[model samples]
Target: MRRVYSIVVSAGLAPALILGACLVLAVSPTLVPAELAGLVRYGPFLLALLGGVIGWWFNRGRAVFVMALLLICYWLLVGNGAGISAEGLAFLQIATLYLVPLNLLFLGFTAERGVLNPRGIARMLILGLQIFVMLMLAGQPDVGSALYRVLETRFFASTGVLGTMPHPAMIISAIAVVLLLIRHKPLETSFAAAIIAIDAATVMGAGVIQYGYLAATGVVLAGLAQEAWRMAFVDDLTGLPGRRALGHAMAELGNQYAIAMLDVDHFKKFNDTYGHDVGDIVLKKVARELARVGGGGKAYRYGGEEFAVLFAGRTAERAQEPLDALRQRIADNKITPPEKSKPVSVTISVGVCERDEDTTDPWAVLKSADQKLYRAKQSGRNRVVI
Candidate 1:
């Protein structure tokens, strides 16, 4: 049953079906005037449809399923109803009744899953479409009346990206904010930055004060959210992967790669000799070196006096050169320990293992790596063993 439902949700038919129904109602020309009220009346259904789709996409069962059902109810409530017009409500129904909810739910779901990287660039792309639609609406011949119609009735108000794109120039600013937030990384490339700037200008030209404020606030909020997420998944002390981050990464990567457990040799002894503060400094220095050496692979602080490195698409034996160089780098570099009043050096031991395809599990692979690490320590103070 669960599998069947998920399949249904993932289908493109979900949104397209809703849109088709609206299109049918639109072409038939009902006596009921399709006004903003009628459009707003069905907003919940739109939201539900979106939520369900997103839920299905991200495997979020309950929220998505519930939203889909609620949306169906909305369709029933507004069907062939009096006071709904066929013409005026055409775009309203399609956008508010369908697109808004679908996009909102999808966006929220993707964000919640921590998969908002470039892989999900489609989310950002849809947002761009919404912005275009809003701009078109704002430029309508009777801009004032259209604005009043969309805003006053709260048509598609439930939609998260601040109603349809067509607000005053100021509203463009708000859209800019939404765009920035939805982006995984801050815009740095020249073309990207220029596009963003142009989008902002369009919003300002629309003359929507609230839009400007919302855009600014949304950008800041998105940045904050991104930072908060990073902190949640990052190690503060060593700048290595924190335990929580490691878990999240494992959940994401599953059994697709190799695991290497690396530990600083005699870490506790160093702390005892140099004090915990200096110990912390040494750990950070080591983490930096590890991150630098690992390249492309992730480095994590597994726990006290221990670090973990994950190498993608490689076997344990393949890590020999990199691990050897890492150990050598640490031994050769002169690290100025914090409050140590002098420079010092440190060494690290590494245990690496490729994922056993027959028994593909991170924990098991990690255990194997740990065992190898133990062997390295037993063999000598500083070395890499598989």
Candidate 2:
């Protein structure tokens, strides 16, 4: 299941789906009902604004404010503000539209829970506002028709360049990609950055920039859904699948399977000696190792220093080597506490159980593993009992 998730995310599935939706509109604008088509054209702004509002109400209120700022910045740049029709201006300078979304993406990646915070968002907005003002000033800089005129004059002249010297759009694009690659949620960030790149290439069509915003919004929506799923089914401390996800996994498993219950040895000592913070670090490290256990096992955090590893289509005999190796690995890894130089190590005791012909319930098999886990813990922890 995790492999499938990695594959889908790496393949850019979310943006692909949104891109498909956008293409349908671009291709068959008539396919939509008259009312819907009008909504598509006129309602997008309102709908996107509404989404920002909804985000605020959903405790992602911070993002709504950022969205509002971004919307205002975009409108200021693209809207009919100076009595001079924006339509009349050559789009060569319009590459400036990339800033707002790029700003949001960078801010979003830095935001807590993926929602841009007020202080950070404010700074970005202020900076973005200043940049927009600068662009407006650079509008007729006979200083040059473009920044890096050498790129057009001497370098790749066919594809050409946009904006003036110190090309902010290209700079932001490079910075966005680098930042996204380093951030925790690289896939989503990179997806938004990729969309921005495509938007940069088609900046002439003003409408394309809006599509880029919509695509960013789509990523935000998908992120919300993924967060909801994580809160319910992923263990916060260990970053592993939780009990709810374990139940779902078992539901899809074949009858032939082995399950193991693991408990961190002397986990209470960590909390007593250091704090839950250190305990959390231990759990996360332990889960990380368990996730890579051999024999095609899947790991889950089964609440409070305890973990579960399920090996579908594998018997207890086949699962033993991996379970024991997992035990040995946990025993060997030294966990370093934050702000402390001394490294400490912990171990785990595991109990493995296989589904029998008479046992139809996977939970019952899990219970068997649980019982054996207790026995292993009782008989001097750090070994696997099957």
Candidate 3:
């Protein structure tokens, strides 16, 4: 939770700083170099495309990923006032300031699922309706003026505590951003930031669009991409570092180190007797026990039914106590399978080897540990053999 909170806070603050800078630049365009003004003017679409690409990459072709395509379309259609009646473009500008918030809300509500689900379908329908209304209102300035007058008369006037944003749209947007931050979905948070930033650009009247908004969104997308990379190296079933990660660990280990190769005894038999689902639970339980091993041990899931524990700068004898304790914990643990009447207990066989005169290479030490593990299995499992 703390990690999630920190991530949310960081993503939230990034957009705030970005939008604030945008507003400042809008006020004092002179502070921005004339050379960079062209980039600021024409860079939003490209940056929006970059953000979309990053989001698509992290999500991995999920249906919700198509939102990126639609987002690009949104930039092309409404980002700049173009190819529309002057009065219609004015209406779109006014409508989009409020509509973007709704789009963000829709994105947050359906971050994982696509339009196939009920919530997603409904939101998309309403969003389509909003776009249709915006299109209809385009080139209709007299209606826009009259509608604002009626709306102004109907709603009760209220003053904001912060005088900088007295309008209801700004207050609603602020509330939406806070709510999205609380959800802690990285891509959703970034999407909301981009929407809010772009809308703020519209409200500021500094320019037709602010490319900085897309740039900020791209930063958030980059964070999501990083998380995706981390997830790639993590084992899905046992939540441990995978075999590839174990290779990395082996490469990092010093000459003086102990490697322990462990495997759940009769794992295949257990899987056959119980369902694979229960077998997965057993693996997860054993993984938890192995993860708690001490003596500088770091555990990894080294392929099916097998795991590696690396004790950096420790001898096999020094690491024996922790390994033995881990074996005992797995033996004693009572795991209840889903829809099963009784709890089942499982055991692990460990083979430990330390770097020595005969085994200097990490792989050599690992192979030695594996051989010892095979010996333990032959001599009745559930014990550590060195």
Q: Write the per-residue lDDT of candidate 3 for residues 279-319, one digit (tens) a residue.
A: 89889999888778877899999989999999999999998
Q: What is the C-alpha lDDT of each candidate?
A: 0.54, 0.65, 0.68
The residue-level lDDT of candidate 3 at 1 comes to 43
In terms of lDDT, the poorest run of 10 residues in model 3 is 60-69
Candidate 1 residue-wise lDDT, 199-257, digit = tens: 33232332322222222222222223333444565676776658887876776664457
Q: Between the candidate structures 1 and 2, which one is better when assessed by lDDT?
A: 2
Writing each residue's lDDT as its tens digit, candidate 2 over 1-386 gives 75476445442465567656765655555677876754554433564486576655565543454455445544544455453333323332353445454655655565444336656456656666765664564455442244324222322233444422224455556666566545655334533544453454244354554444455555555544454455677787777889998998988888799999999999999999999989888888898898799899999988888889999999999999988988888888897888999989889999999999877699999999999999999999989999
Q: Could you tell me the lDDT of residue 98 within candidate 3? A: 56
TM-score of each: 0.48, 0.76, 0.70
Q: Predict model 1's lDDT versus the native.
A: 0.54
Better of 2 and 3 by TM-score: 2
Better model by lDDT: candidate 2 vs candidate 3: 3
Q: Give the Å shift of residue 52 in candidate 1.
A: 28
